[model samples]
Target: MRSDRRTQLLRRGRNVECASLVYNIIEVAVSLTAGFATGSSALISWGVDSIVEGNSAAFMVWRLHGEAAGISEREVLKRKKTALGVLSAAFSIAVVFILYEAISKFISGETASLSWWGIGILLVSLVVNPLLAWGKYRYGKLTDSPTLKYDAIDTIICEYQTIVVLVGIAFVQWKGWWWADPVAALLIVPYVAWEAFHAGRDAYQVDLDASVSG
Candidate 1:
């Protein structure tokens, strides 16, 4: 019975991660298109962030599936470390790209045009991302999976990015504050960098634990 329950939980976790991956893909396409259309640095950066999150979701899917397949404990640990390393690298790349885009906009004095599409998508994300995060958190705790927990935190960070980008776009539309867009993009940097640090640290810790166990 216990084994069956564990199997069920792993199945559910995979479902949630699959859903997250699909959503992130759609988000990337839409956000990039809207960002280019309106010249919004925030939207572009959000799209890049989505790519990073999508990769994380993919990693979780792989990890959960591997567990369900009864992979060796050592193999599982190795996969976990690899997933964390990839996640950290992906986030680091996002930070660099977003920073460059935001700073370039500021230096060039580029102003984004109002984008109802971007606003509309962000509003939808405000509703969608929280539910996904909640699902991840619930299953993460139930299954005692640190990777799922980390992915949940990443999802929450995406929610924060949505709010920041939405406000930036709103200000550009209403207050004519062109700088708000780049500022919002800049704001996303700290959050992404923080996550990158945590992922890297966790990966290193996992390596130490493995070495000691060996």
Candidate 2:
């Protein structure tokens, strides 16, 4: 690829990451507030996931910025590995937190109240996250950036979680199924764990490749 085009793609990736960071920050505040008020385990897990997403976006911003500044391939790989490691750890933590919250709610026979605010935020995310993921995926492919691709996957996961949480909320509100909220939160765990495993494995592989080449 041409140097100018590469630079442009990197710049665009950085911008996408920045946008994701900003969105996740707002999402965290609103989701957490609504989750707590309504006692929705699924919503609370969504808020926690937003925190992880925000951190991932911050890491991508740094990694993309370094690459755009003409960093060496080895240095870039190192940054990617470090960012992946952090993301892997963050995802694992989110899984644990979600499991704990969901299980406790299940055991306690707790039910969440309906929150129009939570529903509105999730509806907005259903629209916004897909656009962000598309931009990230497109730029990541153009630039051959594994970090951005993984971030895109994370964004897509958030979209899936949004759908699950919304469905759970609907069941609770309409069908009087109090178990739906925690069950919905639990449903997100396997996918998240799968990504966490891949991120950690990729990070290790990157480190090994760097060692062999160095």
Candidate 3:
């Protein structure tokens, strides 16, 4: 009975991870291209957010599979921490670039080209992200998998972050307040940093078998 429950939870994790991977891949391509062409900070931030989402998905694949395989403590800990380190670095770099571009674009008074594709990506993310997050979160609860849970939280955060970015984009497109996009994009940096920092801390705790949460 106990074994069956764990197996079911891991299966659910895999399903959610697969879904996340597909969505992230599609969003990244569109948002990155659109952001660069339009010089829109909000679009760019969403692009970065997509990358993070993809990373989370990739992490989920490993975690879900590891759980399925009944991963050893030492190996799981090492893999989890390594993933966290790499992901945190990627996020930090993105924040730096987003802040720099947002400021530069605002000061230069350049208007980003608004496209329907950007809006479409935002809409897709709004639905897909929450769905994925909820799926992973529930399974994580059942099995007590921190990695799975964190990935879901990251997904949800991406959803919120994207919405915030879109709001900025809307203001720019509607009111021509170019600065609002950048400011709003900048506002999310602190929260992203906080999430990344906590992820790192959790990763470091792996050696102690904190992955089991007991």
Candidate 4:
């Protein structure tokens, strides 16, 4: 009975990870397409942000699959740490580029054309991301998986990014406050950077723990 319950939980985790992968891939394509069409740098940056989240989701999928395959805990931990470290580096670099683009837009006083596609995409994500994040969080707690917990946090980050992007676009469309777009884009940087720092820090701590144990 105990073994059966464990198997059931593992199956559910795999399903959740698979769903995350599919959703993120679609999100990246939609966000990039709409962003380019509308000439919205904030939207473009948001699309790039999704790529980072997608990579994290991919790692989670890999880890979950490894667990299902009866891989050793040590091996899985090593892979997880490596994946988180790489993602942390990617997040830092991405944040730099996002900030640069936002600043350029601000300085140039550039205005993006209104895009219903961008708005529509964000609306869909606003619904999807929160639900997905909550599911991951609940499962993570049930299983005591730090990786899933942090993965859910990454999804939460995506939700926040979606909100800021929508607000930026809305302000321009509603009141012609052109600065709102870039300003809103800039707001996303701090949260993303903080998340990256924590991920990196956690990965390092795990490595240290493993080293001491070994």
Best by lDDT: 2
TM-score, structure 2 vs. true: 0.93
Better of 1 and 2 by TM-score: 1
Query: In candidate 1, what are the lDDT values of residues 1-214, reduced to their tens digit?
Result: 2388887998898899999999999899999999989899999999999999899899889988887777767777888889889989999999999999999999998899977777778889999999999999989898887678768888997898899999999898889999999999999999999989998998888852452121
**Count of clashes, each model:** 0, 0, 0, 0
Rank by TM-score, descending? 1, 2, 4, 3
The TM-score values for the models, in the order shown, are 0.94, 0.93, 0.91, 0.91
- lDDT for model 1, please: 0.88
In angstroms, the error of model 3 at 76 is 1.8
lDDT of candidate 3 over 118-197, digit per residue (tens): 88888888988888899988888887877778787788878788889888888888998878878877877887778668
Model 1, runs deviating above 4 Å: 208-214
Candidate 4 regions exceeding 4 Å error are: 1-4, 208-214
Which portions of model 2 show Cα errors greater than 4 Å?
208-214
**Model 3, stretches more than 4 Å misplaced?**
208-211
lDDT score, candidate 2: 0.89
Each model's lDDT comes to 0.88, 0.89, 0.78, 0.80
Evaluate residue 199 in candidate 4 and report its C-alpha lDDT on the 0 to 100 scale.
Answer: 74
